[model samples]
Target chain A: MTVLARARRVREALLGGRNQTWHATEALRRGLLLGVGLVVAGVLAHNVVLALLGAPLLAASVLALSTKPSGTPKVTVLPVARTGEAGETALATVRVDPGHGAELLAIRLPDKGNPGPGPVHLLPASVAEIACGLYRRAWGEGVDLRLDHLVAGPDALIVHGPMVGREVSRVLLPPVRELPAGPVPARPAGLVGVHRSRRPGDSTDLRTIRPFQPGDRMRRIDWRVSLRSNDSMPYVRENHAESDADVVLVLDTRFDVAAEIADWSLPARGAAVRPGGSLDTAVRAAASLAASYLRQGDRVGLVDLGRPRLYVRPGAGRRQLLRLRNQLVVCARSAGWSSRPVLNAHQVSGGALVVVLSPFLDDAVVGATVQAARRGNLVLAMDVLPAELVAEPEDRWGEPVRQIITLERRVRLDALRGHGIAVLPWSSAEQGLHVLRPGARRSR
Target chain B: MGRVRGRGVPGWRLRAAVGVVGALIVLVLAVQGVTAVLIGLVGFVAVAAVALPGSPAAMLLIGVSAVATAVLPGEPLRWEVLVLIPLVHLLHLSCALAAILPRGGRLHLAALRAPVRRFAFVQAGAFGLAGLVALLPSDRADPVVEVLGLLGAAGLVLLVAALLRDRDRVG
Candidate 1:
């Protein structure tokens, strides 16, 4: 690298990240001093005895000017790890050096899917000591820690800390291949197979056998053995088999509700998973869910129903899961961009399950999800509820306004269910996966 | 920066400059107060000549003494008083100079350490002598004035000690 490039790199490394710079207001300081001096001069001019006092005042002003502070300390953040795992710490070291003396006020670390209890403050210059082992508690079972603010310097020193226990996984789904516009034939490789331990009736292998159970189907009975023994007890068999259903988790990253600042307007809503923003939360949740499904011996993929049309091919293996997670974390989506411009559900293979995780805030994304369901794919829509529903503090406005807003959110959710899509409204009180599901009336 | 071979300024020149400035300040004060200018000038020059042989700053003490005497309310001019002023100035100057410019006699470690010890000892001795003179009952001045004179002498002793300490560190 050239000298300029090296210098720029060094400057960036020292400063931590780009920030606004402030200059000392010397003119203001001088003006205040001049006013005080004038007052003293006026008081001393009354008598000859007091006239000598002006000499000391003049000396003091010159001394103050000569002893002005020289330089201002600055902080800059450098390269940071793009991803981290849940229940594990991600290390982010920042350089904090100052041109002159300064006292560090506070440093704000990103919420690793968990709400931080309080801000951390380091040792002052006079103390000049450092504590090594510091750790933050995990937010939930699978939440990614996100770094937020780092403040350092008046004295130049680099401080390193970890963002502990957060969910960081990548998902890459296969490109959506168009299905032929004709009668579909079952490909031999795509056929859903049954376990072998059970009697052969639509099965390839025999599944396990057990004593007769209440819910055992009669058609699965071995009649020949029953006649020979004149058996009074009937035996039942259990089948453990893998399904051929392909699950495509469509994550909406258009407008995340978790991005808004939590204040008096937003109450102590459970642990904030996406304090960085809603888009980040959606991306993280989608990645986590994709990994979870893939680990269960299922062919899983992802479709970001936002801008740029991020489509990872359906595949199995640890590497494919990582790739998908990486893509989700780094991809950016435009606000007004619609998913309808890219995807159509009729093009998907039969028996595939399309799981759409969205806030359902946009008409285009919602429309695309409905079209996917109509195409014969087992569609499961996981509705990401707006954080504002629970985030809004009840005391901020009168109870009536809060109730109205809650009622309106419910109406929107009901409208989504009306279209025959399973909706899940996320809540802090329960696990996001199990809390909200389609009711009997809505599960068409 | 250009490198010069020897000590930057000659010791005699520094001595002469300090002596001249000291004498001039005393002369100006005497002139402004309408005191006998000849007496003040002679007293200043005598002190300078004696103090210059030792360290330059001794001339400052000599000048201060002249100023004190000039400001004193006394009979204007006496021939005996004029002689005594120069004699006292010469005695103080000789003692101070002797402390700086060592006399060659013994080649012992004690002789080598004598200059520093003598400098401090002579400085203390000069203050004591000045104090004795100021304290003596005199028809010439007030007792309060004598006390002030003693205090000024003590201040001179402190000045000499500070100068000696600085010179010792530099050497």
Candidate 2:
């Protein structure tokens, strides 16, 4: 290749997708202008000190101008995990093959990702690895990071990039706090589980004596009961077997309510569920319940009423729990106010315990919750609405509107309770469970 | 919502350091009367450059201030001017560094070691060259020779700068 052609090829290889121009930085311009300007002025005026003062600028200019960075270095950013927990830190890395004469490399983590314009790192020619730390503060699916890179020549006078970097996603699962998986009514459809089944089988709970059948194991024959019978028929004690139940977590993603009730009138863009908002509370509660039940070896499933497309089938294991958590994040990301809340009969299995988490802001969601109870599934409606609602600043008739909504909510809750569906606020659900447990004292 | 948290070094601290250094240099030269105004203006610009460090205005200020400090007509060569040189250089350097660094970035002292060392070497060479020039036999120069010397330096700077400009297509 000709010299010009060869140089062009080399430049292309080095810069990759970055803008190839070696632009003058503020440092270079300052050095050149001040250095030469002072030197010439000193010579004209016969002032030695002034000329001497300009030497560093001259030296810097010379050093920076000696040679241009030769080739472009391609940076490959590694993919980060799609899911993480709140307060957890995930690590990511970028790799580069050093371009010719490439001296200083800087990578900026975009502000949209986690936060901050990450770190500025100097790369040793041989060491091309750059690691980034991503800290997840709150739950939700968010852009993990977008990389912005700038590569400087040996003296940092000439720079090659401020180029837009690649963007990656990171989903953060809501934190799961320790919560008692309140007493769910016995619906032992599965043969193996943690809940106690009333039927006779191998378990700790003792039941009344019954005649021993042919298939009954000899070890199960209660010698005391058989001898006491004193009849031809042998009597054996029966015990309840440990069985599992199906728990379906029904999330109502129809609306994300902020604490200040007046915000409803404002633009919905800023109307995201705040840290202690209704959706946040519901997500935390659901994660806690899923984790607790799954740990107990019970089957747990997830259903998004707002977006039925994101349903998770009932499963048991650590991996399934991870899927459920990730699915929950997806549900929250697409969560919004829908015209109607959907809870198809097929979503919940027969005799499954359906826990419906909702703010009950719309009449549609209330109807859906009641419909689930009517379908023979035991339903627990978690009132995810904040206890206090603030009046909108712009609305002149705010107080009356607040009172009317409050009255409507109360009536809807009462109607749910009247229909044999358990209606309790999220804050009270755990405590209510503690109260419902047999012989368990209710802690204030 | 777009605000970034967890910065390793606060940006304000870097700006403050640059401002303080620039102000001190200008204050020490305040005795130069009218000349002090020009230096003070440069100092003010330097501080403003903290907020907008990457702009060409900073480079122009550095040049103007250096010339102002040098061209004060009546004053004899003072040693304090020597001290002022490094401080001004540092002000320009710090402002430029602060401007280019990403938000929330901490200074990497090790990465700066080379640049700082190069500057220190140049500074020492400058003082040495000045002392040597002072010791040389004095020759009264005609206006022609002065103009020629100035033109020669300017020509050399331009030539070197042109040569340094990248000729090949940028990637």
Candidate 3:
């Protein structure tokens, strides 16, 4: 058979008779032909028993044809949850208001018949709601589940559609691990925030005890200190003002290398980013840190090192956290190398904690991290490389090649640490940042 | 991609069940002196009916057996015809459904419930008619009844054609 004929046969087997309203099947013809032929032949032979044998099929044909399903079936596809974390299974339902005539429904779903991915499902039309478990393995914005459906009439004698349902595109956010919250370098400007500021104000942290100021509240006075003074000089305690920190999450989208050393050179195949790759790790790490800082009432922002157009300005609140996470998705979606990683000093304030998340595959990112450090910003270089490297099985020299690459990368990371930049690998990202208590990470 | 499937009846199980029914009917017809060629024909057609239900082999399996009963110069009111009537009808009904859902498909048992129920109802009515037919004198040759059966068959074929044609036009 020709390829077209073969495809049509396969399609009919899967999704019965596409795009047409319910019509007769081959069985209908078989029944009518065999039934009438047997009855007529029996009469010609003057045999009453022969005529009786054809009665059942004749009755079946009439019964099947009589069921004329009335209304046009309307199919509605809805995902119970539009957004979910990567690797999470979400439920998507395809509801068919089979109107009057539909008997069977054939929908494309991720089912056993289709061994690879999503494909056809044949079920009774009475089942209006078909809940399919849609799993998105990769991160970022893309189509999660697509329902291509059709309807068949009674006895599967007729069919109505093979219409493609609207694609259930969901924003599969990169999974955010609840990392330990760490203090960011608070910019001296903001007057109210979680961190203690140098300028004395109405925070609970006591800065010092000195002679009572004219504007000091009565609550600030220390009665014990006033009693201790022989000169009758009253002393009041001073508290530091609270300030919010600007956390610029810098993502290096240059190299999205996976753990497999062999696949490192390949562009992302059939996926936005390679699963467990450098870029995937970076996006997840950025989202986690953003959530952590924003939870602590600090201003969080995003800087896409490769594509500057995707930069999210520093803002505080729950919404900023969401925007930062979404921008991280956009970064993953359009991830590629542009001009070398950019981190101009003006992109962030003087004391903003610039957490540069990269795989450390190149010195350019290391140099950018060091440059931000030199610009008086507390820069933390987050190495988001996959923890384990897998060598190609067939290649004899693969292990040596991976070893050489590993040694070079290790030296690069060590160089960044030597420049006073805290190199926090993704595995220990939040843990190492906790050491940057206030002025600890700031060299100047 | 998320793959989902529920508890289902395999297509082969239905085919095999009907194949057994067809085998019984074929064996009953094949027992006319129980020849080797007849036995071979029964075996091949029975397998084809299940393996390729939509193919001409299924039609031949039922058609050849029914024709053999009529042409074998046997008594018209034998116990064999009564048994063949239900078994052959069941095999045909199963093949029709099995053709729609091949081995590649996931067949839910519920999908077959309606068709089977209808088959049972139709079979009940057919048995009632067969019981009535069983009372008729075997020696009687009614010319008027034969003419009426021929006319009814012709009218049915036209009516079926009209229904199918009307459906095709609207579709």
Best by DockQ: 2
Rate residue B123 of model 1 by lDDT.
38
Backbone clashes per model, in order?
39, 9, 5
DockQ class, candidate 1: incorrect
Which ranking of candidates, highest lDDT first? 3, 2, 1
Runs with alpha carbons beyond 4 Å of true place in candidate 3: A1-20, A45-54, A77-81, A84-95, A107-124, A127-139, A142-147, A186-191, A198-241, A263-273, A337-346, A436-444, B1-92, B95-108, B125-140, B169-171
DockQ of candidate model 1: 0.01
How accurately is candidate 2 docked according to DockQ?
0.31
Tell me which of candidates 1 and 3 scores higher on TM-score: 3
Q: Candidate 2 chain A: worst 10 consecutive residues by lDDT?
A: A435-444
Q: Rank candidates by DockQ, best first.
A: 2, 3, 1
The candidates score, on chain A by TM-score, as follows: 0.46, 0.80, 0.80
In terms of lDDT, model 3 sits at 0.75
Candidate 2 lDDT by residue in tens digits, A1-444: 799767766766775642555566767767776777677767767776567767667776677566667666677778778877777877777676547665566656532243533455443333366555777677886666766667766556777776677778777878887877664545556887777776666887887778988888788788887887767678777888878878899998877776688765454453234577777888888888899888888888999988999999999989888888888888887787455788999998987878899888877887887888788777888898888877776778987888888999898888888998777787777787676555211210
True contacts kept of each: 0.00, 0.37, 0.35
TM-score of chain B as predicted in candidate 3: 0.81
TM-score of 1: 0.38
- Candidate 1 wrongly placed segments (more than 4 Å): A1-82, A85-245, A257-285, A317-322, A331-336, A339-342, A345-349, A361-363, A386-421, A427-444, B1-171
Question: Which should have the higher DockQ, number 1 or number 3?
Answer: 3
